[model samples]
Target: MKYSISWLLLLLFLPFAASAQTENPVYDEIAPFNEGLAAVRVGNQWGFINENAQMVIDFRDDLVWNQDADTSIPGVLGIRYPQFKNGRCMIQKLKVNNIPFYGFIDTSGEIVIQPEYLNITEFDQENAIGIYVREMYQGQNEIKLDIVEYIFTEVVVNINGEIVWPIMEREHALTAKRRYEVPKLRAKLIGKDLLEFKTEDNKWSVKKLNLNL
Candidate 1:
């Protein structure tokens, strides 16, 4: 009977012993874990740490900042910081004009894609929509007016940063879409290796990407 009681007590105390071995580092802010990694901020720089509290990614100041104001909005991009989705995390750099360009990094902190895309969605089913922007100025001689226009071209990109297809909204028309409300036109994975996009006719068109590569 004494042996059985001792075994029961050991089982109950095992949990407390294991919990005591966990590490607790002093961080300015600690975010919830995503993909087995958590974002930790020390001072103004941010880095990623594993579940064991080991810093897997070094701290950097150039990550895309999360706006605290957007946290209250529903369905809006209110992530406290960029997170790893599908073994990749988003990073940003400033262009010559101080515009922000985004790219991705692997869990090992390697830059898989250069920071050249104007905007990109997180990897969904090993595919994402990468948008490139071009600015144009149209001047009207008669009215003596000049207006700025932004042309946005979205492409279906794979996890390896390869453009599988340059999305065409209309048949035989290579014209890109406007920057107004770009999120609504992002490509979505509807099924296995199938991408669904809204066409210019307000109809949904499904395209199959070469996922084998």
Candidate 2:
């Protein structure tokens, strides 16, 4: 019997790989490790696991996907996949207005940003911005929500839920432009206080942030 170096390497690695596969014969799907954790799918729900093969995050509820608005839930996102970056990751939930919205979560599994937007950007250790449905209160202390009622606009917000810059829209720039120093674009912090955005003209716009973490 004979074997090539590659074959020998494969032989050496197979046991460990097989062991891992056998040990966690639970999850139906899994993702790459980020922040020392990996997202895994079991049944329809998803959760995270530690490097040492510990199921650190339990798969509780399934992340619902692209449905129409529910007109009930406060927030929702249709994303079923997520990866950790800069200690935070994006996730989605069930139908709100029967549709999904985007939000952020920390490595510790805390919902730092409520899933209130159809789009969102990853945080760069300090700030982020997203297009969200403006929350409204109506009579009877109820949350009034309808996509058509409010225009989608971008605004500067942090993990602490503080709005640094006022909201901005694409079509009506002059008003938002006057209220805010600059119009909000599809923007995220690429570096310290540095943001890169895609303008309505599809041009790249860079702005320096003047807010604190």
Best by lDDT: 1
Off by over 4 Å in 1: 1-23, 69-78, 133-152, 169-185
Error of 2 at 209 (Å): 1.5
Model 2 residue runs over 4 Å out of place are 1-23, 61-80, 137-148, 170-185, 200-202
The top-ranked prediction according to TM-score is 1
lDDT of 2 by residue, 1-213 (tens): 356887998999999999988886676778779779888887667788889978776675634332253323222232335556577677766433344566777767788777766555555575666676564444442465432334567777676656676445644322222253222345656676676777768788888777753
Every model's Cα RMSD, please?
10.0, 11.0
How well does candidate 1 score on lDDT at residue 57? 95
**What's the lDDT for residue 1 in model 1?**
100
